[model samples]
Target: MTSIWDPIRIGRMALAHRFAMAPMTRSRAQADGAPGPLAAEYYAQRAGFGLIITEGVQPSDDGQGYLNTPGIYTEAHVAGWRRVTDAVHARGGHLFMQLMHAGRMAHPDNTPHHRQPVAPSAIAPGQTMFTAAGLQEIPEPRALSTDEVEATVRDFVHAARQAIAAGADGVEIHAANGYLIQQFFASNANRRTDRYGGPIENRMRFAIEVARAVSEAIGPERTGLRISPGSTLGGIDEGPEGPALYRRLVPALAELDLAYLHVAQGGNEALLGEIRRLWPNALLVARGGRPLERAAADVEAGLADVAPVARWALANPDFVERYRRGAPLNEADPATFYGGGAHGYTDYPTFGRALVAA
Candidate 1:
């Protein structure tokens, strides 16, 4: 029986446990798109997890979607992240920065430049996003030209290199959650006739190109990707071809021999099974809002090599310790989840510390 406490290898990085900390947008970055001052403490506190996947970090200025989310394209951004990476490494933990491009989900008011959001097409997601003022409607996005699309690939490559330079163990391309890459994958979100759109292969071209460029820039051993199959978030409609699209995409990613493929399970058991079968390398599955025992069962049954825990990891910094001792967990407060100070960020006490205080 392979318990979640057992060690595992994902690419060149060896994890101390099978529990990985999934990326969650905390909106705690500086106003200039740099990581907040307490970012290091926040991640370091959760170092008990086998791997720490940082929140969605924009690859370029136009990638900004929500206010105070971090960016990885600037010197200041690199400096800000260095503090985080150093803190995690000192605690003997591995960290992967998730490179995310917001695409059509972005609001101009949320970004520093107030520039129009870009997507695969001009269609809007028909959703609201949090801005400086408050929640506002998502406006129609400008479609990227062929040349611009190629340029965006380079932007992801640049961000991957920056993450490595800042002392990160690796980078995970954020292809999930109806973001830029998922926008290209969804049929309704992408209705172009160019080589980068149309058929499943064409729709997958942008994601493959971005992956290839990032893998080439920073060795494949230091790269990973996160994908959400059949998700309807951000108004994405992959239509009836959703499963078929992933069947093609997963194998293509496996051919690159990248670090790992993280699947955010969205109630598609058949597609999830096929993804696990097609992927020859390490596969990580995330079952949102599920108990830790379910994650253990998945790994024990060989359904997944690793399992990512989100909410529990957020509220319990000493999640591994709590699970080990069967200790009570602190409930996560939704009110303080985003754009907060240390009160909700780094103030989560460890099991031993909490007991002492009690």
Candidate 2:
């Protein structure tokens, strides 16, 4: 049995330990959708994690859903992320940029162009998002045509290339979390009659296409993807055939031989075991809302190759060191979790380093 402290080789990259920092949305980017001023510092502080999967980065203008989130298409974006990558590398840490398209979960007020959001269908997410003014209801999005869908795949490839150019170790396509790709999987969120909707095979097409294109642009060893089975975020439901969909989808993805498969556990243990059996490469499991001990159990039991830590990593920059030392952890402040400067972002003290709490 492999322990969390043991070293592992994931694809082309060899890591010192089996723990990684999960991708998180901090909402601290610049007005132009570039990384925030303190972005490099924030990431480099968590360098001991060995592998650091960054926050979601938009691939195009249409992909932006939240305020001040980073993008990879623009020149400024590449330069901004370059600093982050350089800082992380200096500390002997590897970073993988996660490409995420928000789809219909976006509001006009939060975007740079203020244009209507785009998705597989025209349905709204029935959710309210915090904007510059205040909380506002998300409006219905326009449906994408078949031609537009193909262009979206190209956007992901472009983003992956840009990430490599910026000195990142790799890129992770965000196919989960009720985003654009997952929107096509949800029957309620997607009502199209095209090849992207209706059947399970059709729904999984967009994700497969994006993954294939990205892997071709960058080596398959540098590309990875994240998926959530049976997730209901962004007002989505995969219906009764949800399990069947993944039973087929996971193997189809495995055929691509991606660097790794990240599964965000969504209350499905048996299905998770099935996914472990299907994926031949590295498997990263994020057990959100559960104890860290449980996540470690997955790695020890050979169900997961890596344990991606979230809230605990967010609250403790030297999380690995503290855990090994059996020291106390600082509690994370919920109020400052999103859209903040240095308080909850980079002010987290390491073990025995006295600092004011948020």
Candidate 3:
């Protein structure tokens, strides 16, 4: 039986342990969508994890939706991230850039250009996103013409190339959590009659194209994708057809021979196991709602190769080591989750140091 602290082979990269740091968005970047000094130290401190998937980074200015979030399409952004990647590599960790495009989930006040969010269709998420001022209703997004959708795919490719240039081990396409790709996945948000909407195959078109383009831009060995099947966040609902969509998507993704498939499972063990069966040979990292013990069990049962934790990782930088020794975990401050200073970011002490103090 393998333990959570044991070494694991995840695609082309070898992780020292099976514990990965799940990507948690901290609106700590500059207003211009560039990563700041604090962002570098925050990621560096948590480099003990087998892998670090970064916060949703915009592929272009139009892709940005939240205030003070980072981007990857600019020279300055690449330079800024280079510092972060260098720090993580110096500490013996692998980092993957997560490219996200917030589609109908955008609020005008949250973006730099204040551009209307774009999606596969003209539908809106009917939810509000945080802005500099306060919570504002998400405006109806412009439908991406087929040409524009192709352009968006190219943009992701370019961002993936840029991330590799910035010293990242790989890139993970953020196709989850009601972003651009998920917008297409959800029938409620994508009512288009085009080839990019309607049936499951058409609805999965954008995501598949984006994944193929990114895999081609960089080697497939350096590409990964995150998906949340049947998640209804941001008022997205695909109804009964949701499961069928992923049943097709996972096998198709597996055929691409990409690095890994990080599935954010929200209490659907049967579906998760089904996906595991479909994605036969790839490194499947299962996340979402699994306790640490269950996560370890999932790996031992061959349900997944790694288990990612979000909140616990935020509070405990030395998560792998702490879990290995069964040390008490630091409680995460929910109030400080989004936009805050070093208080809840990099201020958590390791168990060894905490024990010494006691």
Candidate 4:
């Protein structure tokens, strides 16, 4: 049985432990899309996890979906992230920058160019989001032409290169959580007749192409892909073929011999097990609505190589040490969960450190 403390190797990065600090959105980046000033401190504090996947970073200006999220396709962005990656590496932690695009789940006021959000089809997520002016309804997005779709793939490739230039150990393609790549997986959001639409193979095309391109740009050993099949977030519905889609998609992505496959499981044990079997490389699984203690269940069961934790790791920077010593964990405050400063961002104390009011 694989214990949570067991060492694991994912891609070319050898981790000292079997858990990953799950990628989370902090909503604290600069208006120009550079990472926040305390990003280095924020990430380094959680470096004990060995594998720290950073927040969802936009691959382009058009990929911004919320206020103050970070981007990775610019010199300033690379400079900002270099500080972060350097801090993590200093503490013996490997960081994988997650490349995310919001698609139609965006508001014009939230982006740099202030242009309409783009998706595979001209559909809105029917959701409201926080912008500079406050909450606003997400308007209908413009459908991407086949030519524009190809350009988006290059955007991901460029971002991957930028991540490497910034000293990241690798990059994770965010094809989950109702983002642009997940939008393409959604039947409701993606209604185009292009090669990237219609059948499951077509819907899976953009994601695979982006992965292949990113792997080509930055070696496959330095690239990983994340997917959440049957996701309903941001009003996505993968339709009835969702299960079958992963059954085929996982194996297809495996042929690229990518670093690892991170699956965001929605309590679907059967599907997750099938993905574990299909993927030949390291398999990192993130379980929703589960405690950090429960996060190791998949790893112990031989169904996952590593279990990624989100909220617990966010609240307790020294999560691994606490688990090792059986220390009481701190609870996270919902008030400072988003768009906040170091109060909740980096003030979370390690086990015996002085408690700060959140």
Task: Encode model 4's per-residue lDDT on 188-274: one tens digit a residue.
Answer: 888889889999999999999999999999999999999988779999998888899899899899999999999998867889888
Task: Write down the lDDT of every candidate, Cα atoms only.
Answer: 0.92, 0.92, 0.85, 0.91
Better model by lDDT, 2 or 3? 2
Q: What is the lDDT, from 0 to 100, of the residue 52 in candidate 3?
A: 93
Please write out the lDDT profile of model 2 over residues 1-358, one tens digit for every residue: 7998899998778898898999999999999888999999999999999999999999999999988789999888999999999999999999999999999989888888899999999899999988898899999999999999999999999999999999899999998999999999889988889999899999999999999999989988999999999999999899998889899888998889999999999889999999999899999999889865575888999989999999998999999988887778879888987897999999888877844333
Cand. 1 TM to true fold: 0.98
Model 3 misplaced stretches (Cα beyond 4 Å): none
Better of 3 and 4 by TM-score: 4
Q: Judged by TM-score, which candidate is best?
A: 1
In order of appearance, the predictions have TM-scores of 0.98, 0.98, 0.96, 0.98
The clash tally of candidate 1 reads 0
Q: Could you give the candidate ranking by lDDT, starting with the highest? A: 2, 1, 4, 3
Better of 1 and 2 by TM-score: 1
Cα distance off (Å), candidate 1, residue 325? 1.3
Where does candidate 4 stray beyond 4 Å?
A: 355-358
